[model samples]
Target: MKLQNSYLADFLSLLFPQLCPACGNDLVAHEKIICTDCLYNLPQTNFHLHADNIVARQFWGKINLETAYALYYFTKGGKVQNLMHHFKYNGMQQIGNLLGNIAGSQLNKNEKFAGVDYIIPVPLHKSRLKERGYNQSACFAHGLAEKLPAVVEENNLVRTKATQTQTHRSRFARFENMQEVFVVNNPERLKDKHVLLVDDIVTTGSTLEACAIPLLNIPGLKLSIATIAYAE
Candidate 1:
C-alpha cells in the first residue's frame, strides 16, 4: 500500500511539476527549491578558509569584525539573485533553510566559523514582519543552527522602526539611513559571546553594519558575519 502511494505521488508530481525557483526548470523528484545544476553551478566564494577575503576587506576600518564570509557571489539576474528574489519576495521561505544548510556544511569545514556561541539574524521591523509573515534571515538562522553549535536568537536584536528604502542610495547615505535603527533587546545573552550575524544578501553591507553596532557594545562580544550572497 505504501509503495502504491509513493508511485501515485510521483505520477501526480509529473503532471503538476514543481519548477526550481532559481532556474525555472522542472525540479526532479529528489530536488527541492533549487535544482542540482543550479546548486552546483552557484558562484561560491571560498572565503571561509581565508581570513582576509573580499568580504573581510570590505569592513577594513569601518567595523571591528572578527571575520566575514559570503557563501556565493551574487550577480544581477543570476541564479543566486533569482534564488534570493524567490526567498525574499516570492514567499519561498524554505530556500533560506536549504541555503543555510549548505552554508553551515561549508563553514563546518573551516576553523574560523567554529566556536560561535550565538547565531543572530538581522531583524525586520514589526510592520515588515507582520506584512511578510516571517523574517527570512531568521529562517536562515534556524537552518544554520541545525548544523552549527550556536543557538538561534531571533529576538535578541530588532529594528526600532521602518527605514526608507535603500535600493538607490549612496553607500554613505545607506549607512546613515540604517543608523540607530537596530537595538539589542537582550544584552545579557550577547555579552562575552562570539556571534555569527546573518542576513540574506549583502551589497555594501550597510545593513549588516547597523545590526553589528549594537552587538558590538556587548562586553566581550566578538562579531562574525555570514550572508547567503555577496553582491559584487
Candidate 2:
C-alpha cells in the first residue's frame, strides 16, 4: 500500500506540478512552497546573532527592546520581495509560516530569544483584516510558536484606527499617522511577561514604534521583536 501510494502521488504531481513561489521552479517531492535552491539562496540577515544589528538599532531611543531580528533582508525586485508579495498579497500565507519556522529555528540557537513567554503579532484593523481575510503576522507567529516555547497571543493588542498606507510617507509623518492607532485590550495578560512582538516587515520602523508604545507601557513587560524581512 505504501508503494502504491507513492506511485499515485508521483503521478498526480506530474499532472499538476507545484511551483515554488520564489523561483517559479517545479517543487520536488521533498519540497513545499519554496524550492530548496530558493530557500538556500534567501538573503538571511542573521541579526539574532548580533546585538547591534540594524533592525535593533532602529528602535534605539525611540523604544526599548530586549532584541530585534529579521529573517531576511528585502531589496526591491529581489527574491525576498517576490516571496513577500506572494506571502502578503497572493494568499500564500503558508510562506509566512515556513519563514517563521525557519526564523524560529535560528533564534532558538540564540540565548537572547530564550524564555519568550508570549508571541504577539502586530494586529491589523478590522477593515484591513476583513479585506485580507487573515493577518500575515499572526500566521508567522503561530509558526514560530511551534518551534519556540511560547504561546501565540491574539486580540490582546489590537488596532483601534485604520490609517492610510505608509507608502511614500516621511518617517515623522508615518509616526504621526500611527499615533493612537493601537490599544491593549487586556494589559494584565501581558504585564510582567516577556512578549515577542512580530510583524511581516520593517522599513522606517514607525508602525512598529507606534505598536510598541502601548505594549511598553504595560508594567514589567519586556518586549522583543521579530519579523520576516527588513527593508532599508
Candidate 3:
C-alpha cells in the first residue's frame, strides 16, 4: 500500500499530470522524480570508473584533486534539471537524497574514490539555509553517507559569508565572489583526512573550487568531489 503522500502525488498527477521531466512521459509510481524510460535513457557520464575523466580534467593545474565524478550528464530541460529545481526551489529534499543513494551505490565500488575518511557537503549560507530549511547538498550527502564507508561531518566545512546566487554570475565572477564566502570552522577535524565533497550539481566548477581552496591548505588533507549531475 502506498503512503498518503504517495497516493496524493498519484492523484495530483491526474490534475497536474506528472510528466517525466526528461521525456514528457507519465511517471510510474516507483519512478518518483523521473520515469523509468528516462532513467535508462539519461546520458550517464560514467566518470567514476575512470581517473582521467573530464570532471577530473577540469580541476587539473587549478586544484590538486585525487578524484572527481559526476553521476549524470546534465541536459537542458532534462529530468536532472527538474530534480535540481525541486531540490533548490520546491522543498523536495527527499528526492535529492534518493538520487544521492543511487549515485553513491555506483561510486562506492569505484577504485579511485577509495579510502575516503569523511563526507563533507558544501555548506549553504545561513540566509539560504533558513529559507530552504535545509541544504539540498546535505540531503545528498546524507544519502551518500548511508552507502559509503566513511563517516559524515556536517559542520567541519561551512559557508561563513552570505553571497549572491551563482547562477547569474559568470564563472570568473562566481569564483572571485566566493573567496571568503566559505571558511573552515573546525580545521582540527579535517587534518590528515581524505574527504569526499558532495554537492547537488557541478556547473563551471567555480563553487566547488572555492570550497576546495580553504580545505587544501589544511595539512595532509586530500580531496575528491562528487555531484548529482555535471553541466557541460
Off by over 4 Å in 2: none
| Deviation from native of the Cα of residue 220 in model 3, angstroms | 1.0
- Candidate 3 per-residue lDDT, tens place, 21-49, comes to 55667876666767887667777888987
lDDT of 1 by residue, 126-186 (tens): 9998999999999898888888988999887989979988898999999999999999988
Clash number by candidate, in order:
0, 0, 0
Better of 1 and 3 by TM-score: 1
Best by lDDT: 2
Residues 1-232, candidate 2: write the lDDT tens digits.
Answer: 9999989989999999998888788899878899999889999998988999999999999999999999999999988899989998999999989988999999888777877999999999999999999999999999899889899999999999989999999999999999999999999999899999999999999999998999999999999999999999
Pick by TM-score: 2 or 3, better one = 2
Off by over 4 Å in 1: none
How close is every model to the real structure, measured as TM-score?
A: 0.97, 0.96, 0.88
Q: Which stretches of candidate 3 lie over 4 Å from their true place?
A: 1-24
lDDT of each: 0.90, 0.93, 0.84
Query: Superposing all C-alpha atoms, what RMSD in Å does each candidate have to the true structure?
Result: 1.1, 1.1, 3.1
